[model samples]
Target chain A: MTSSKDTEHPLFQRIEGVRQRTGRVRDPIVTQAHGGGGKAMRDLIDDVICGALGMSAQQIQEDQARFSLAALAQYGDRLAFTTDAYVVSPLFFPGGDIGKLAVNGTINDLAVSGAIPLYLSCSLIIEEGLPMETLRAVLQSMGEAARAASVHFVTGDTKVVPRGAADQLFVTTTGIGVIPQGLEIAAHQLQPNDAILINGYLGDHGAAILVARGELQLETTIESDCAALHGLIAALHDAGITIRAMRDITRGGLSAVLNELAQASQVHIAVDGTKLPIRPEVQGFCEILGFDPIHLANEGKLALAVPSEQIEQALKVMHAHPLGQQAAHIATCRPTPAGLVTLDTGFGGERILEMLVGEQLPRIC
Target chain B: MRFVSEFRDPATGKKVLQQIEQQLRQLGHDASHPLKIMEVCGGHTHTIFKFGLEGMLPPSIELVHGPGCPVCVLPVGRLDDAIAIASQPDVIFTTFGDTLRVPGSQKSLLQCKAEGADIRTVYSPTDALSLARQHPQKKVVFFGIGFETTAPATALTLLQAREEAVSNFSVFCNHITIIPTLEAILADPSLRIDGFLGPGHVTMVIGLEPYTFVCDVHKKPFVISGFEPLDVLQSLVMLLEQFRQGRCFVENQYKRLVQPQGNRVAQQAMQTVFEAREHFEWRGLGSIPHSGLRLREAFSAFDAEKHFAIPAQQVADPKACQCGDVLKGAIKPWQCKVFGTACTPETPIGACMVSSEGACAAYYNYGRLSTSRKLEATR
Candidate 1:
């Protein structure tokens, strides 16, 4: 290889001319040798990660992922970047695993910013005793999910810690995307009379994870709604729905996202408790454990604030999309009672829906 | 889901609200002439705020939040005892999830857990027994805290542990009785409560006749209410009807669950496993005699207090906290000195600010806007 001092930067040149070092990992399970920073590490990186990603082994040998800036700039005027960590217990859940969750979660973060996600970086902190086959399965899941979302994993890292240093595995993903020119979206941009809309039911992921933990014996079939939403967001952008702001309802659930928007815009958000989209199984689970579905978490769900005029069109487009079949207009923002969000109980009464203070631990009462 | 959803029907809820209004008008009361009703269970308090029941009513009828929340009423001294048991290295301190945030004198159970304590939040006491079975070497102690509604589960769990000879399982019994606490509230002269909204879950265990002391002796109207929005509204009408007829006795609005004699099997289990303490110190209401339960001598082997040394010191509520006044219905939660300004859910100074079922938390989280609206109206 030519030294950079006399050669063109890789990002500025064609990557096709680079040479690859073919290797394969032989061990049945991950061990300390995989993290030795030597040939074994190289083998694991090349054979496992690169093979699953369908990329040349030399692509990960470099210290950095180099993509042509001129080519990336053609898609949009601005770049959006975001990162997320997945440490969900039991790593594998009903519908998704840590790998799939990591990819979708990061993509959703960028999608909410009105960006078309393109490339991602993955880092896996694995416990020494995890089976190689399990790692292979997870990597395969990451590859499949990324392919489905039309995003590429250009760079990655794998660290094997001593046993007991961490749980079985942890995945952190950083995504980069481009925002089309003139497309602006933000929580603060929300205004009065904006119709609050959400895609699908709330709290499926949280309920699914809770049941998967196998602590609460009462059971019904419920699965996590983990999915990539960049395509759904793109459809709205394409349909000219005038999307003002959007957020994937994650950790603290739908109420947390709405509270953030209300606080930023200094507006009152009114929602009908009855109109909220919740699956019967989720409702039954919440009923048994004294949990409010509104406070429960979701992975694939998104809450968007659209201008009142485009409410019908936004719903129509979202309903047509595969990921947003249950899209609903749930709320409307008003100017008064600033920085507050309220729920109409449909009992001729109204109450404030505050941000959750701490972990929504199950209550004994 | 069937029974639960039916109780929440808005059409039926609207009819209940109309009937409540009509009964209030027949009693010749409006916003100016208020009838103060105290719902004496944390579950009822939760139901009220969860459905915004307060805003549906005329301002003249005030619902006073009582000290029925077991977590809110759990004295900090007892929480310190619980933390002490939890901090032991080999002890797996199991408790209901809601009690994790209750502030003890030294630190909360959650804080201890973060600092390497083996704390687990179990859905039921039997889950603790399962833990004891799984980890035979570790000591499993269930921090039992609730009203009669949750007491039976712990009682039954202890019995099963005994039969199975689960040597490592024990209970830090903090289960409380509702009768003595209700008696303490009724005796207080500072409060002027016109009626009572009874706790349905507790009544499901103890039944209707136990409330005779509440209705016949005190001549106060009592309605055993269900924990639903419309159930709450309908119960208010039933309570008001008792007032209009100038009759005072125990009424069962939640007839679907409560029997006059209650569940004999649960009562039998509790009677066998537990006995009243001489005096149990409440967080806000101090030293209500025979209000809390402890394991009986026969089941002393299953009691954690006997197995581990407990602090048992009486820790006072925070100086600025007016939870006692709020619990006694002498003042509204917002009228307290530290209500929203100093004591909040994020940094709670009192037990009332910790649990979702607690009145202050229920109001602060769900009805804080009404307080602002009232201030604006006054302005």
Candidate 2:
């Protein structure tokens, strides 16, 4: 249990004072009565959801969250909205869980758009048999993560389904943020000779998830690289380096992200294979299972295209951040032969990458 | 990763390239038609294309991707049998993840799985065996498919099943051998391959003695290489030096793991539980005699083929698909009539387009770089 620094904000502290008189769900496990809109549901919501998030601020009694237009306007000129769902198997994994992923993943969706993520709305669909302890732990994690990232879980919903209806728990988080004035990062802005930079090691989350499934019977120390990225992006913006375009490497991994960027920007990207910062254990896992690290998922890692002259400054800012300690300049963007991505193997050959067609099945041959 | 990383040195690879180029110059070979070499293992083909090894080498050298991928060569009829068996009630069909998407005559195992069949992908045969132990009332069948390197695992698993008296555990053994298939390829008069990068894992199982015929009878150079980049380059140097001196024989460059006699314990396990079938049908090539293996009479009780009746129909490859030519080095994958057109990986009309290790799939995935017509293939 870690303390959340952002919870010390005066606005949330006021809610904390009011929340001290709330009710509790005495049941050890969730049941149908929790979804019946009765006293049971109110206690579950008040004690579990609002209690863990640190600030519900009257949103539980209301249908929608209220925000100050001027306060939001002060942060930026435009509003960035994004949504994602997490139905990951086993809900809990090393370094993070569905709760942490729900917070960080949605925050990243806004941050990568050059926005300062301000608030998130969470909805949880918990299966009937889920232990009350599990829900509390997950909600607690969501609160800690959001609080630590200086974002608020201003509104939320919780529903309990029949045991067979869901796989333990499902979390969906929607985030909105503000894009500061004069910040115009986009894929189409990517130009020839632009350098591609990454925050840290690639594919840890994907490898960690695959190994956590216990299908391959492999032993590894790899953990999911799940963390909030809005702060890291803020550091980059503070340095005043032009970020041509930025994308968090999540599902379909970096190759898929680069392919989309290349197509959108109409530029060819040449990735130096040696420059990729993949951990040896992750690489070995991919080797044994016949998976490509470039096509594997990451939660905290991001790829950004920046101007050639701004490369060193951008990297210096990234290196100073706690999350971007292993930041690397990996590839160079060039006018193509558009919509093509290639990896220079460092063995004197260039291997072209296509979007991974489907699930990266392990090869036996 | 110790032994593995040591063999991927780019510096050593460059030095080997110099010697190989020098040796080729001395041998008087040029890029007019090119000196063709066949690496007769899908694992080797994967390495060659993955590292862009074929493109990095001298332009005069061409690597003929052989019919070594078991998933690629699995006949449509056998796949149909597997699907029919898997679709049965109270039966759990297990296979390597690589074989899940391979197209059968009608549908693939993955499609069948999607249609509510219990087809599970396992990393090893033992995992399937565990499933059988866990579900005693249900039939658990491991779809055992590979060449010599993979057959031993299936063999050992079957032996363990017998030892444990696990009645529900069985193997759909689609295991194949290397020598007879090589013999069949060599017998083809149309192929004019100059040398061979021998299948390292297969050679490690059958041992080097079995490949002496390729030198004595066929008079073609053979070099068994490791899967790593540097080992491949070093093996090419060995093969080229032999070609420079007009020598033809089997040489082992993967001495770290591959021995002259191979793993005796694994060979012993294989000999105990299995015997070669008289003839086995290949997808590209027709029937090759004594090429595939099946459970021995003593272990027939643990054989899935014996346990369940299947639609053992001989389904033909599509009329336009020329996978045979690609496997035999007669033409490049792109040269096929339906290659990147009617026979793409998404809707593969040929068996070769099914597996990543297959030359067609590898080419379609890794080699299709250009937006329009492909670059002249270095493979």
Candidate 3:
């Protein structure tokens, strides 16, 4: 039996070597031939995907990775799954690119749910004539982000369309995570008197992307706050703090997230404008463009609702982490006047923070 | 943020609030009949709501949002004319972002854009000129809309286009003078505004001499104010002091920015490029003589009205909308029947409900909840 097993292993090893030797792509630009179902496609995949992601020979050969039943049972029966598509114009920005955004975005979605992100499936749609260097840079960014977050990309697919049929490139990431037992966190779980905390300043990502677009023609030093947050979340749990709900402040920003929580939990959220963390530069950018910072987008920052009793411990844990060095207590949930978010202005007035109707556009006058 | 932070200091704001209260007390004003001060600039209205200045004021003082939002006062007929020009196949229509959402009789620029119209939002007319330069094959028309503050920028851009010989670039000039609009407001008997908080930016262009009419003819106090929380509060104090002393005169509280003679070069550029229209119909207030500006005969080649054949037909305001009353400070925004029910930022029924600086949009988005809470607390 030992002799038979050794012979089978050598046979598999020999097949992988032959495949690797033959499947080496040389073209510097993506073309229709790279996506066609032939040797060219295999060569492109082996050179671009496996080389950049550093996939093992055995892992690259499998259609999908399989896990043992015993390993899956340790994290409980619930699995968290989420998918997101990244299509930022300009493809690259001050601090991150589309590939990094795809990885961090999906991981954040799962992380905010109190789950441990484990695996991700990447899919790329490449336009013909895209330079290989750009692809390599993007793939390298994705690989580094995945490694930093400690998640594995076990499977992926690639398709090449005609030039102008798509943008230079687009990436979609689907992530799966495991939720531990006895842990429940959801938007609807927010209770009255819960403390609302933010991990850091808002609008950095939005301001950075806006400047990177080159429309404003103004210089800025702001960088996108795109990052994974599962490690900071784990630290919070380790601190023995009970987290009721958490949400990453993205597209519509802090105002949107607060409104969502208010509507889901049927409570009122009163945010103090002075207490909300905002960088001076971001504030200046919004001032010139006539935008409200609360409505601006964020990437790495998150809003958390913890029981009043555990807020102190949660804040301590958050402030100790690198990502949460600027953590702040922004607001508090109230039992009365359900489904509303109000801001106590720094200038001493109260106003309702509503979800914006459409995109916030710069005012000329 | 240096110049900005000092004007927004909460301590200074409180001190100004106390002075306003003291002046009101000297004038024997109370909540029963609050002293209504109309700030005739959308920028001031925006600052008031953004900083919660209204709530910080004494109940004896009331702020009346005025018809200073250029987007809010654009007649629907003019918007339709703009849309008609924008829908042409070879035309690339450009406008400020806030103006894109203002509804015409048939459709808004946003809706037209979604249906494949080439409407782009530009920060300034210069940006539109750049687009024109890039797309020489397409006819570029800029919807130039603003008061005197923005008119100078549009004028300068047009002058540059002429110098560069960019034949494809033209402007649909809807620039209105503030003096005429303010005069129209004062002439109205329904509006009980005791004093006026003049627009700082506009006065920086037109100068203080033009606003002296408010004091000379109407015997009403007018204070040129800056667009900051402290500026607004301090301006209110100035206006109240005038009321307390029974004086009606023009004061310059924004002296740091606005010169007595205004910006000479900007004024010169405007004169070189534009001439007053015979009459221009305001959205809420009816036609005022020589209120709007049009390209001069020398610059007719760059006039959108003359370049394109547009249907310049008159369309009446929605009957359900009381924006005229709102603009004239005759009624508060919430007092309008369809404020939150039908006219909202999402589905705006009036121009005032569309722009961010519009009184209705500001009240709807920021003031409604707070006002209700204040009522609840009082109860």
| Correct interface contacts retained, every candidate | 0.79, 0.65, 0.85
Best candidate (score: DockQ) = 3
Could you give candidate 2's per-residue lDDT for residues A70-109 as a string of tens digits?
Answer: 9999998999999999999877888899999999999999
**Cα displacement (Å) at residue A77, model 1:** 0.9
Task: State residue B73's C-alpha deviation in candidate 1, in Å.
Answer: 0.4
Tens-place lDDT per residue, model 1, B179-262, is 999999999999899999999989899988888988877889999998988788888988988898898989999999999889
lDDT, model 2, position A149? 92
- Candidate 3 lDDT score at position B316: 90
List, residue by residue over A243-328, the lDDT tens digit for candidate 3: 89899999999999999999999999999998988899999999999998899988898999999988788888999999999999
DockQ of 2: 0.48
C-alpha RMSD of candidate 3: 4.0
Please estimate how well model 2 matches the true structure, expressed as its whole-model Cα lDDT.
0.89
Model 1 reaches what TM-score against the true structure? Answer: 0.96
Global Cα lDDT for candidate 1: 0.89
TM-score: model 2 vs. ground truth: 0.94
The 10 consecutive residues of candidate 2 chain B with the worst lDDT sum are B370-379
Off by over 4 Å in 1: A1-23, B375-379
